[model samples]
Target: MRRSERSMRPRRAGPVGRGDRGYVTAEAAVVIPTLVALAGLLVWGLMAAAAQIRCVDAARAGARAAARSESGADVVRVTRAAAPEGAEVRVTRGGGLVRVRVTVARPRFPVTLTAEAAALDEATVGGGGR
Candidate 1:
């Protein structure tokens, strides 16, 4: 065999160290679960934010209904309709003002969202001057 022929042949790679044999597999085993959990958390966070917005809208709707002197049942119905699932509504009236609060809780996740709003009673809108 010519020296040039031996040099031209492709060299085989050296054997991997025992420690490095399953390193990539171990990393993937750990990293995949971590990544999936992170993605789940992100999705849950987005859902919580959306629920918070719904709470705010529900509160506002209830307040408007109360301000217009709608029946208590009607105000509650409106608020609940606008709120996220498993929501609670509270209405308070005083000093010619109506206040509404909405609270929401998710069954799968341990979190609570709430919002409150107030509006002047329509009947109290005007009354001034001698």
Candidate 2:
């Protein structure tokens, strides 16, 4: 073949580079799982926040009932009804004040959430001093 003709002919294709082959598929495989894990973490965080809100509400309800001179059993019942599932309620009275605490366990996380509220006991405020 003449030198000019050889130069005019097309060059043979070379083997694909390692950097280009299957790159998109590899990236997608990594990214998809990472995105799924992030979504799961976000959902778990939202659930934990909701549980914390429930605990706060339940503590407030129990504290209000206790301040109004409701019986201990009734206060606990009301708090538990307002609280999230698997939550614990505790009421304590000290020096004309009623304090209520609610604790809830997180299903996906290892941490526990706690909320507390306090109110002045109405009975003590209106009663005559000894």
Candidate 3:
């Protein structure tokens, strides 16, 4: 081949230069992972909040039921039904009142949330010292 023909041959581009003129791919690589992590965190937070609310509601329901002369086992059943998945429920009744405690455990996260509730005696609900 002639010297001019060799010179006319195109030279290969470098990594810094060529069609990739901007940081589009690099920027996307950083931004996408960050956005994905943020989304995961947001979903986890929402799940935790929902679990907390369910735990509280479960405790309140169990307390109310037990206060109305329902059995402790029944209270536990009701609490479990109302509570979020993987929740532990404890019910105690004495002195014409009932108390319920709920503990929720998150499977994906290392966290536990607790809620406690009490229901007043029927006498208190009706009137004091009838």
TM-score: which candidate is best? 2
Where does model 3 exceed 4 Å of error?
1-22, 94-96, 106-108, 123-130
> What tens-digit string does per-residue lDDT give for candidate 1 at 1-130?
9999999999977776865898899999999999999999999899888889989999999999998889999999999999988898999988988999998755634776889999998877776222
Could you tell me how far off, in angstroms, the CA of residue 21 lies in candidate 1 after the best superposition? Answer: 1.2
- The lDDT of each candidate is 0.89, 0.90, 0.83
* Pairs that collide, model 1: none
| lDDT of the structure predicted as candidate 1 | 0.89
- What are the runs in model 1 whose C-alpha is more than 4 Å off? 1-19, 106-108, 128-130
- State, as a TM-score between 0 and 1, how close model 2 is to the true structure: 0.82
Better of 2 and 3 by TM-score: 2
RMSD to native for every prediction? 6.1, 4.4, 7.0
> Each model's number of backbone clashes?
0, 0, 0
TM-score, structure 3 vs. true: 0.73
**Candidate 3 on 13-60: residue-level lDDT in tens?**
777667666679899999999999999999989988888899899999
